[model samples]
Target: MIVVQEQDFDLQHEYAALRQDCPSIGAIVTFVGLMRDFNDGDNVKSLFLEHYAGMTENVLADIVEKAKSRWNLQAVRIIHRVGNLLPSDQIVFVGVSSAHRGDAFSACEFIMDFLKTQAPFWKREQTEQGGRWVDARRSDEDSAQRWEK
Candidate 1:
């Protein structure tokens, strides 16, 4: 599942719903991304997020499909928020369920790493001093590259 919305999500409810069926789902991994109060040395006030409508969802779906092709997973869920948001808000979530812990762990991390660098979401942050656009981290690219091996 892929959702881009302004509303927040319930992590526990999502996990529970994902586990409702198939006892073979032995391991479930989830990652939640939050809007931090600080960016670099600036105290963040709020964030404005913008994403390409149809294209963004298609990119995420393609990533999910890639993970599915590589692993024996039972279920996968991804949610991302767009529009104006405040500090300490939920930004994104990724969950993966599998029969084994290894696939669940690896695939979950893989999805997040790829999303961070590849997802075409633009962010402009408001801070105590001023507002500025946030750049994509090179470290995120390095993190994703690890999975290529």
Candidate 2:
């Protein structure tokens, strides 16, 4: 599942949903990204995100497919929020379920690594100096590269 929405989500609810209807699954891993009050040595007032909804969801599905091909995943869920957001707001969520902990953990991390680097979302950070478009980080690119064959 892939969701791009403006409303916040319930972490507990999503977690429970991931575990639902999978009696054979033994592991579920989830990650939630939150907005921080500070970034790059400045206090960030807010963040505005934008993306073509259909494109974003399609890319996410591709990332999930990659993970599934590499690992024995039973279920996958990804949710990313766009538009104006304040500090401490939940920004993204990735959940993976599998029959074993190794598959679940690796699949979850692989999805996030690809999502961060491949997703077509744009971000503008509201810093004291004014709003500025965020740039892609070398670390993120490097992280995603490690998974490549």
| Residue 145 lDDT (model 1) | 94
**Model 2 agreement with the true structure over 1-149: per-residue lDDT tens digits:** 89999999999989988999879999999999999999889999999999987999999999998899999988999989999999999999999989999999999888888888999999999998999999989999999999985
- lDDT for residue 72 in candidate 1, whole number 0-100: 91
Error in Å for residue 18 of model 2: 0.7
lDDT, model 2: 0.93
The sequence of per-residue lDDT tens digits that candidate 1 reaches over residues 56-111 is: 99899999999998999999999999988898899999999999999999899999
RMSD values for the candidates in order, in angstroms, are 0.9, 0.8
lDDT values for all models: 0.92, 0.93
Question: How far in Å is the alpha carbon of 29 misplaced in model 1?
Answer: 0.5
What's each prediction's TM-score?
Answer: 0.96, 0.97
